[model samples]
Target: MVPTSSSTTDRVETFRLGPFVVPRIWTGLWQLSSNAWGSASVSKIRRGMARHVESGYTAFDMGTINFPSFDHQLIPRTAADHYGSAEIIFGQFKRSLPSPEQIVGATKWCVFKRTIPSRAVVLAAVQERMERMGTTTVDLLQFHWQDYSDQNYLSALRTLKDLKAEGLISAIGLCNFDAIRTDEICTSLGQGVIVSNQVQFSIIDTRPLHGMADVCEKHGVKLLTYGTLAGGFLADKWLDEPEPDLYSGNLTPSQRKYLDMILKAWGNWSLFQSLLHTLRAIGDRHSGLSIANIATRWVLDHPFVGAVIVGARLGVSEHPDDNQKAFGFTLSDRDNEEIEAVLSQSNGRTIITSIGDCGAEYR
Candidate 1:
């Protein structure tokens, strides 16, 4: 059966990531970076993180430590600020996490400068990231590559496997890796070495189900999905709205990118609106659940997916209460058929062939 959050505390659903049981819905800090999703002050970021933890989100996904602005922002003072904020958010209401192990921190092995670095250089990079996050070992170290032509991704994973052996990273996984590549990794590293594959999996993009799902299910690697909400475009706010232009000031880099995916991969604005309206109808039947909740639950119901990475727009937007409702219900066969009915008519039906498999856009 597909994993769901606990019936008593939907906010606290946990799944095994290797030996660690982590939150089913992770709080993503990709938006916490500078200008990527707009400017969020440090104080706001800290409070938002605390609130996310207070609301039972303990798994945190981030990868901006090496960014120029974020590197400067990772001083002792910033850590102190977040420590204080977390104290306030959970100290009075409940016991706060005393150590890094209490809250899972997952970061990426970024290969921005080079497609593949020497094993020593890769080890050094992981060490630097661990220091910046103020943890000795990262719970999950997800790797991403800019170019697929470089076969050195295999060597990189081999290095990560060595690091995992030493307990520097509790688990190793991939980010934006296609199904074929994922299967290759499984063959290269053995079945249980890779724990999860983080990729874009949403109503607008179900490419993971086309091939990645089979490989992951066979190899036992869970799929951690980003863009399940399609950069916030899958919610009720955009239900019947007209399409915003590419250069719209209100759209952040993330929104623009995902909006373009909708335009290119999912067809025109009207088809997207039809999908939204259908999601709204589904939400109406489920105790007035928001469109976001329905969209997220649909992804969660897929047996191959272990968690969904919903962006925590730091202090700007908070949806902890509403997110908790995602585990409150299941999408019935009727609901799936209704959603697929709209999807079949939309261009998303042909996206697998149009765009290729998961992470195909990057390649």
Candidate 2:
């Protein structure tokens, strides 16, 4: 279906998704769908979606980076919701399918990971997705590679390109790949491939600037940044807490370790508090925009970033108001100095080696 842009406050931006356009800032369902999923029944999951769309999030993130999503939520939820709801399924013929204009469904591929299984193996996986999602095609299918040493990466891209040509997918993307590896794929495909690079970009993790951004900019490749809030540590709740050993509620073990490193790099609890305090001061000037909304907006404001993946964990906590604040105001140069003043005391570009790459936070 032809797509139209959604209205947003001036601070927010939108990008074209084939015919569909989506907010550059979106709520990622992975945080909730990560583990507690067996308990994440359909009704409960739908409630999460209801709250998400209500909060103005119109996109999602998934791929081989986390296979649990492909089998459980991604494929199934797509199937259940792709068709029109009972209101139309009961016989309103014109409403037999979801309005293609309504939401943007996106997922990625860990193609470099060597999980393709086989040509048929990969085909069956997405076919199951089509059957389960009940849609003619996936909006975006991102590729992920585990090791660049494997020459099979290009083969995987070829398969994806073939599928897109076959009209089975709308757009293709790459996940967790560095400049070297992305160059390999792009050089192989030339102009016929990837449109976006999903990476880990935030205030703390700026490794993408090491050269990835320039490459993407040259290729017109979009970067969808994650960890903008550094897995919630940038929030006010951490302003007084002890360095957490094991964080609970939607954060994975890697997330806990990642944030702890940030706290350490910031120079112990003292420096962290300084950063939080500065964010609070800057945030106060903006009528209660939390540190998270500020940090996320900073990433959103960056050029070449088509979107930022903000984790969503409904019921336990809802940040629709704070999330909305991201699009309410802009960060000033002085405010950026206040933030950099705190960040200046810390080791920048260290998170990349620690985590390996942007999407390397997985595993």
- Candidate 1, residue 347: lDDT: 78
- lDDT of each candidate versus the true structure: 0.75, 0.63
Off by over 4 Å in 1: 1-11, 63-97, 113-116
* Model 1 root-mean-square deviation: 6.9
User: On a 0 to 100 scale, what is the lDDT of residue 339 in model 1?
Assistant: 93
> How do the residues 1-363 of candidate 2 rate in per-residue lDDT, one tens digit apiece?
212224423434578654557778776655443444223444555555555555556665542243321112222212111211211211221123256446666665443334545678667655655544566776777766665667677887787778888988888888778877777677788764688888777877777877788778777778887767876787888777775654465555336644655754435667777888888888888887788877887787777788888766544445755677777567899998888887778776564565454554442
Best by TM-score: 1
Q: Count the backbone clashes (under 3 Å) in each candidate.
A: 0, 14
Score candidate 1 by TM-score against the native: 0.87
After TM-score superposition, the amount by which residue 134's alpha carbon in candidate 1 deviates from its true location, in angstroms, is 1.8
Please report the candidate that would top lDDT against the real structure.
1
lDDT of 2: 0.63
lDDT of 1: 0.75
